[model samples]
Target: MHYAPTWAADGDTRRRPPLVGDEREILTSYLEWHRATFELKCSGLPADRLSEQSVPPSGMSLHGLIRHLAGVERWWFHIQFAGEKVPMLHYSDEDPDQDFDDLSGDPAQALALWREQCEHSRGIVAAAPSLDATGIHAASGDPVSLRRVLVHLIAEYAQHNGHADLLRERIDGATGS
Candidate 1:
């Protein structure tokens, strides 16, 4: 049997005491906390449950959320940071909305893939010396720096994790701080 990557487990370790630091360190720490929080939101859920579309009118099951986020990380960190023209997995040119289309299925597999993507993203970010690392947004041809991507990624995860929290609670009445 396969296992989700341990790195994908999102727990409340983000609740650590605030740290006193320079601006860069503080921003980096904030991004890390959100990433961890996002992971915690889906922790311990079975494959079926993770893939279930808990919210109607939206294809955002826990599994789908994981996949979508992984894609986002790849877009911002890998493609943007490295300036590569990589193809998207669930996203397409015609119907770009398909990115969140089918998130309900194979919870373990989705989570594992998400973890792998996160690892790749983290490695790229870590190797960079400054957030000002340069890249271009493929869609807009707009300039995007590593710092901006980091902050945007953190915000994205934080928002989705909030949604995940509510969905998880609805599923099993399990809540985490």
Candidate 2:
């Protein structure tokens, strides 16, 4: 009898994390997958839909998510990790939640910024000689390792991707990672 191969579901174009390899390679690959998955969840959405607070009583929108993620990339990778003296994005002491609450600008601009931050993050990760390389925690006077930051980032994206999935389904009838 003939049998069909069980593959990842249709439209799943992301690379599978290495079956066996360096720890850094596996972690980074998984992170890239999560990032792409987040983007995929937001795909094909118009700016209006992207900006909709589809899940009512929550101020979260896809546009806001994009801005939030971009800020997170900078916050973790550049400011905390690379020790770049750059200002934080979408945030001030008075409005800590602006990243998720403010959706007033062009969403395309937010997306572009997200993409740029992602690229910058990739560069920082690549340049590091070891995952053991440490960055300072701005809130505390302790060091954080690149490995920990990468894992945390992957988790962050995965959690937000779940929110994105729900938002996309509510906006349209599409679903899946």
Candidate 3:
């Protein structure tokens, strides 16, 4: 069945971080909330509009963010934390910014991949015994803990969500991410 993306009210969909919780619970909740915020920013937009870049010289777009975050989710959760040997997605040393530069792919597909990555990340986190568990950092080849990964992903999403906020506003004057 074909489904059209729709945006619901913030309170209805967005999850607030728990007032009290363990460190892992708090961290994961914040990360998940930010992930939802990014998706919410892109909600209800058509494919063409999702690929619309900002004013010249700035290649930032909602579609680009979706692709970029998808790569990041896989990199940190699947490859780095879970030690999965998956091929890179929408990224390469030859074209480091391909995620933002290549707008040829369908936005719907990019969004779907991002959602899948998010689900995979959650599973990885759930299976992990403790936040102290360590994994290799893809770039530095240094050991990093699940806590670090969660924090980094949260910061990454926060930064990209800011970009998404501006991009969405530019696209159709929609505010609040």
Provide backbone clash counts, one per model: 3, 0, 0
Clashes counted in candidate 2 amount to 0
**Candidate 2 Cα deviation (angstroms), residue 90:** 0.8
Ranking by lDDT: 3, 2, 1
Per-residue lDDT for 44 in model 3?
Answer: 88
Candidate 1: how many backbone clashes? 3
Scored by Cα lDDT, where does model 2 land? 0.87
TM-score of 3: 0.92
Greater-lDDT candidate between 1 and 3: 3
Steric clash pairs (candidate 3): none
Q: Which digits, one per residue and each the tens of the lDDT, describe model 2 over residues 29-127?
A: 888888888888777878778998899888888898999999999999998889999999987789988987878899988999999999999999999
What 10-residue stretch in candidate 2 is worst by lDDT? 1-10
Choose the strongest candidate by lDDT. Answer: 3
Where model 2 places Cα greater than 4 Å from the true spot, the runs are 1-12
Measured with C-alpha atoms, the lDDT of residue 123 in candidate 3 is 92
